[model samples]
Target: MGRKLQRIVEAAIIERIGPVTAQDLMAMSDDSWGLIRDQITDRRNGKDGLVARCLACECEVYIRTSKTRGIARPLFQHYNGSDPDCPWFQGRNIKPDAARAAQYQGKQESNFHRLMCELVGELAALDSRYIKHTVGQYRSPTENEHGRYPDTYVEWDDFGPFVVEFQMSGTFQTEISARCKHYEREGIPLLWILFGLDTATALPQSFIDVIRRHRGNAFVLDQAAVAASREQKTLVLSCYLRKPDGRLDAPKLVRFDALTVPRSKIPYHEDRIVGSRLAEIEKVRRPWFNALAQWEDRYKPLRDLARPQSLLLAAAFSIVAATNGKGRNYASEHSNISAMLNTYLSTKVLSPYSDLLKQIIENTRSSSIIKASVHDHLRRYRDAIQATNESPEWILLRKLLPEALDPVLREELAYLDALPDWANPTSE
Candidate 1:
């Protein structure tokens, strides 16, 4: 069997109304269509309400609901005497791929596409900052830039024209690259919003590749906003993005206007640190601190060995001690730990403390005291920096230390670097 017909048209006394899809008619709803029929009906009442028309030629048509015999979906049908030349006048026997390809190349937009464009355009108009800016399907003002029209364009005061594209189907990678370069040459920023349905499930490779070119890998929309729009008949346009991870981030609504710069900081709904995982990490915090403290207690006897070596070890010990059995103190101790590590890395000639530093590094592998101390310290430092709305690149360096260290120690450092900063602590 062939694919069911998805497209239809509406008829008028003098002209035809559409090549509109059945989905578009569904979105218009029965009540809205009833009003349109009442306003446009003939005075003599001789016509049989609003007449559905054929796309290729003017011919009266009828609605085919889901219950209609032999039809798997809602559609429009023509009477026996309808136009023979009409492309869609025949029943569902056309080739599926051919029909789909034609649909993509056709001028008619799908219901989802039209709705997305309308919502974005509506949001753009309501913002006061863009009140004077033109918002719609933008036609470039110059003859040289003619035929270049974005799906949704907002001419802004500060940034000039901002072009947006909502991609719902498969796209070519070469086309994606060329379009980005074209926009760059034109000095316009092009924002791509992937179809919410696809994004919420799995992103297409084309969308993924294009977004990666823009220095990001994730794009998300709030599920709540989608629900609210269905009920309120208004568009609340906001999107959240991040570097693509293996897992999807929590869904939450944000202001649509926040995406002004493609690479600017976009806030997430929840702090990445406050989940059940953090609670588990908290369980190990004290034990880690205690181990580090005990290590310091044992090393105190070495303070009289030599001034240079003793001072460096003492500073390292002091830094770990300041953590105070809590992850919160890691921020303040960051500089001390950094200075000690830098000094250790800079040491060229072997000395009394060289073996001791190697021992400390080795302990980071099997010693719970060393591992927990490092974990809690880095976690606290991450929370502090993230609280300031900054990326924690400084703490990330813990993962990049020289390979001369034990592999296990390097792995632990990498683990610390990878932990998510879910929530910012209240105290510094």
Candidate 2:
């Protein structure tokens, strides 16, 4: 390979979003690219953010912009401190602090940022429930750590304490993560408001980071939001909801109190990331569940749908649904799930799925199938058939029942604190 090819990172794997190449990055929409760019920054900072690692050397990588004909393009670049031995290493890189200083030119806070902070504080104080509001003041930690200088701090009569940080220019991912963790540790609601959002054609990576932390709901205290707050006697924000296609919807004026504050302390009106994804997964499986519930003949519907592996999936899902207390037998007309499983095992239809079935049974709620009878049946039929993870049936099952099958996804969901109850295999 040439020196340039060796230096070019061919691909990278982003946490939660899988693999992407330079071509993939170029194909992404502006908003999508912005989110990936911010996530790369976050991963470089620490373990708290989405991790993007080079597929070549498995070292951390970030998105670097290269301009061609006045049009900016993105490519993956290893971090400055990454392993120098990696084939994709691009010579020496500048330190993050130096780059940040050059970008800001020693001006950490702009006048517009200060003015916005004061204005947000003023609007927050308009509510009758507002007890006190402060701007650019030190907020001492309630516990053992040192305090932080929040842009705006507000204490409500009944709603409790809140902190608002305004995004002006080039807020580092480490700083953002530290502040979020700090406020969450102190049990204070932290809200990040964006400035100059109305004028930007494409959002900067820093703004994208904040928007994603708010779960795809970007809040801006713009002129219209200011007027709305004045009329409503409370803080109002111009909320822009991100669509699935990585584009923003029309801005809507939302009251500060109307936001949904998750456990992360970052609030949003709607969850466009996690909630929407789960809903999509449900939508994909709903028809299968419906077909299974109303199943008359197994060979016709399961075979005619899509993959030949649907029969195994339907059988597995039927067993799981029965254990979940749904009490519907879709695999067979047998009186119980145990009978259906035994029949399949004897016929070698579910023989390749023994291991998969055992995992599902162990993860779900208590059941008669958990008794030794089922295991005995599985063990008896275990030697009769070959089971492999490389099979299409196994792969499909992992995608269909990720909460139960995919350990990496399970860990990711648990780390986000969004693991559903059905996915909790150890609930017993």
Candidate 3:
């Protein structure tokens, strides 16, 4: 008799978010789970991916879909070849290559997959801007070490190169990630078009992964899209946008240029991930900003919220306001930011937050605030402040002003070239 399939993994410890059980995985919103899933896939592809380890043996784990009574749910599973010694080990996973071989029985690409590539290439050539297009051509990157052979490669006169990979079968996460990163670094936009999406009883995990990478967009090249592409003189796709309710919205024919091409080059119609997160962060800080903006004299409006834990926020915002040319002092009755900071430091009110304040000033465009006079003032209060990097204020500031205070978030935004002008540190 065949050995019993390994029991399902129960839980995983995500790097930044802590513990996530199978139930938690299923309960999370689509975007949330998608972010975690994409990070796991990225990690598997050898990028600086999210670290999620099995709760049982501390082995790295990835999220996989499990169907119960026709309803699909996500569950944690150890990667292939995980330690059999672990209680949660599901035995060795069938290698992706071995599974593909068994499914195709020897063929690499399905006949339909090839036909879809040819059709996409033909449709891509409908646009007047199209220069050339190839099917399954080897492409060497201008910068990266390895090269890739995209399913369909299209070039435009002014728009440059674009890649279209047709997803027809189960694809390994590593394969998905490598292609995504390779094209992104090569300055080429990549689009993954799904086949048999309309006929699938339940969408496969591979299809779901591609949709998530596209920020909940699922593209297809149906007859409608083909006709639309020809009429519009541009590559058009039938785009099904995944709603927050975990269901696909009505499919719409969207032009290729209509899609938002982020720095990662994964084209999506809606920014379901980053845009939502930044909006949530902004929502939390909106009230404080409003209150600070209307500051008249130091009264209950400011004092009521100014506990020791929150005083740093007030002072920091005051400095930020000054830098933005507002000249508002929400923290103190002083006329200017330098005077307000000097008063707080001399009185030992903001002394404990000296390190955090210095970091904020140095990293903002307001570095000029640290003049010779201010340096002398800081030296006088140095003994009292006992400035150290381990300030608790950093915790508060990192969340409020992440662009300037949080190194990780700053680096991420910088990479995307999306960092706001006000948050730029190098500006004089």
Most accurate candidate by TM-score: 2
Give the TM-score (vs. native) of candidate 2: 0.63
Candidate 3 at 97: error in angstroms?
Answer: 18
lDDT scores of the candidates, listed in order: 0.42, 0.73, 0.74
Of candidates 2 and 1, the better by lDDT: 2
Candidate achieving higher TM-score, 2 or 3: 2
Off by over 4 Å in 3: 1-108, 196-208, 299-303, 307-311, 319-329, 332-343, 358-399, 402-428
**Best-first order by TM-score:** 2, 3, 1
Which tens-of-lDDT digit does each residue in 1-428 have in candidate 3?
55555467665666544446566577787788888899989988999778887765667899888888997788898887776655566766433344543544323235345656777777788888888999988988798498889999999888888999987666787898788888888889999988657432567888888887887799987656766877887888889988766567878899998898987798988766456657877887788788766766554445355464455678888777767777777777777778877877787767777667777887776676545555566656755544354555576668778777888877756655556556776764
Of 1 and 2, the candidate ahead on TM-score is 2
- Model 1 Cα displacement at 161 (Å)? 7.0
lDDT of 1 by residue, 29-87 (tens): 66654444453343215654454444435455555555547634444566667654345
